[model samples]
Target: MDIANQAALVTGGASGLGAATARRLAAAGANVAILDRDAAQAKRMAGEIDGLAYACDVADAASAEQAVAQAAAAQGPARILVNCAGIGPAARIVGREGPMPLADFEAVIRINLIGTFNLLRLAAAAMIATEPQGPDGERGVIINTASVAAYEGQIGQAAYAASKGGIVALTIQAARELAARGVRVMTIAPGIMATPMLLGLPEQVQQSLGDSVPFPKRLGHPQEYADLVVSILTNPLLNGETIRLDGALRMPPR
Candidate 1:
């Protein structure tokens, strides 16, 4: 679907990959809404991009519902929904502190997996109510962020990997269910990116991580991820699949 003049809601749009996607969509003439738990950062980013900023905790049903309503009220129902809000807390089932708290695992699942589904369901419902945009009867497109951990999780990534694996599984099935309604679902399993989480590390640490990549030997830029998102939104036939954005890096077992 053409992003021009259409509405888009990007969760975790305050920084990192989501921020890059929001800017790209805005540059493409879409009315964008930046959704994130960081109100200040969201507002700042929204101001810079000339878009709406919504403080939202995607993990909460009520919060997500209200944010979506507010966004729709501002720019009409969003036809493009990008689920980039997620947390990656590395922890083993049994850690140095003994067995990991069950709540810790649940927390990751709540934010990464359930939160993704919550926004997808709400956004798809809104998109379904809108008129088809093209000859293909396309109403909307959805892009979700998963992780390479889902496939090759390291030593302390059980919770993170499980949450992302769930996201990967949800992609094709959700796409099949939404196909009849002219909505598309796709997932991106990013290996390693120079996001805020990574940038915060020491330069040596960052370099070490970059060297882990097979060919590029560097972390992916947020813009790289954003570009793929643009491609996914424009390509009518790309749906119901999880695309890995890694640079041929399968990740080592930590």
Candidate 2:
């Protein structure tokens, strides 16, 4: 669909990939809304992009619903929903600390997998309400963020990998279910990127990570991910797919 003057909602839009995507959408003429748990940062990013800012917990049902409602009221129903709110804390399921805390496992699943679904369901329903636009009877498009860990998880990333795996697993089913409603669902499984989390590591570690990529031999940029999102939104044929944003790097077991 054309992003020009369209309503777009991006979760976790305060920083990293989400922030980059919000900026890109705004630049492409979409009226964007940034929904994030980090209220101050969300507002700051919104101000920078001249988009709406909403303090929302994507894992919370009521919070996501309220934020979507507010954004719709301001910009009309959001036809572009980007599910980017997630956390990645590394821990083995059974470590020296003994089996991981059940709560820790649950937390990752809650914030990453369930969070994506929450927004998908809510936003797709709203998209259904809007009249179909564009040639393919497209109501909207939903882009979810996953990770390369989902496919080749290292030793300390059991929970993180599981959460992301669920996201990748959801793509085809979600797209099929939402297809009749004119809402397309797709996912991006990104490799190591220069997100805030990775940027905080020591330079040597960062260089090592970057060098691990096969060809580019560098970390992926958030803007590159945003560019893919734009392509997915505009290309009517892309749906029910999980495109890997990795530089042909299949990770090794840690």
lDDT of 1 by residue, 100-149 (tens): 99999999999999999999999999999999988899999999999999
TM-score of each predicted structure versus truth: 0.99, 0.99
- Model 1: clashing residue pairs? none
TM-score of candidate 1 to 2 decimals: 0.99
lDDT of the candidates, in the order given: 0.96, 0.95
lDDT of 1: 0.96
Best by lDDT: 1
Query: Residue 139 deviation, candidate 1, in Å?
Result: 0.2
Candidate 2 backbone overlaps, count = 0
